[model samples]
Target: MAPERYEADSDPTDLSLKILVAGGFGVGKTTLVGSVSEIRPLRTEEQLSELGESVDDTGGVDRKTTTTVAMDFGRITIRSGLSLYLFGTPGQDRFWFLWDELSQGALGAVVLADTRRLEDSFPAVDFFEHRRIPFVVAVNCFPGARGYGAGDVSRALDLDQGTPVVLCDARDRDSGKEVLIRLVEYAGRMHTARLLDTVGRP
Candidate 1:
């Protein structure tokens, strides 16, 4: 299906699009959603416990005490008519079963990456790629973490040629919003390309 087109001069009625904020554990998925959301974000988080220590890796984010168990929900209005509904997926492997349900009808996704544990983001990138979902990689620049340029990060992640790789501070609202904007634009272009391909086929 051709993706929904969101334009500045869209209809006056509200046009909401679903966007998934996904990444590895403690990679700032929840932070990004909370910072950018206009309303109080709904989070399904649980305190860390001994039982989960075996499965949940806190190697890089050792200071983190909680984890998102289900998903985080939030909303942000880009303009008068265009709005984005953000869904943050759980970072751990066990909760991955819920990803399909949350990703349904999603316009696109933002895959958050932490340079300290860059490999952790591979799963999210692969998931979206295999499903043909348009996404942009937002590298969350954590304090004390090494910084990488967009080109370097793109090459390291082995991302598609046109996939955007932006360095952002997930805790900053403006930065998060910019990441969402990039995703929207990229998804729109991808949809147009697909449509043209279909028409040109026969």
Candidate 2:
């Protein structure tokens, strides 16, 4: 069966969109989902243990003691009738298999980035790019971390020309909402462009 299509001007009275929150370990994907979700978010976090120390890279996030082993689930109503279902993908490579399942019907994705460990976000960027999935990079402004402008991050990440890069505090509801809003807008534009291209074809 064909997948459902999400349009920019679709009926908002009863629209529900699926959005994935993905990024490197400790980049705050879980925090972003929890902050924006109107309902209590579901988490699958496990305490960091000695056995996994060698596999989990806690370089920049040394203070983080727990890791998300599965996905985080949440729901947010953007308006009276428009709601978003958020799925936060586990950041570790071992759990990557779950990503395909979580992203099956997603409208788009938010990739959280930490300036202190920017390189860790590379895999997520590559994943979305290779899948032709519309995604926005939300830089989680961690305290004491060097602040990088959106342009600088876009350049450093080598993002596609029109991909968006926004600064946000994942722990704040307003900031997290803004990131999701940006992703929705960007995804809408991308969908429209693709439709126009298809129509223009022979």
- For each candidate in turn, give its C-alpha RMSD to the true structure in angstroms: 2.8, 3.2
Candidate 2: count the clashes. Answer: 0
Model 1 misplacement above 4 A: 1-12
Error of 1 at 100 (Å): 1.3
Model 1 C-alpha lDDT per residue in residues 1-202, reported as the tens digit of each score: 3344344345656688889999999999999999999999999989989998998898989589999999999989987788998999999989999998888878899999998998998999999999899999999999888878889889989999999999999999999999999999999888778888978855
Best by TM-score: 1
- Encode model 2's per-residue lDDT on 1-202: one tens digit a residue: 1124344345644778889999999999999999999889999999999999899888889589999998999988777767788999999888989888888878899999999999999999999998888999999999998989999999999999999999999999999999998998899888778877878955
Candidate 2 TM-score to native? 0.92
Clashing pairs in 2: none
Worst 10 residues of 2 by lDDT: 1-10
Q: How many residue pairs clash in each candidate?
A: 0, 0
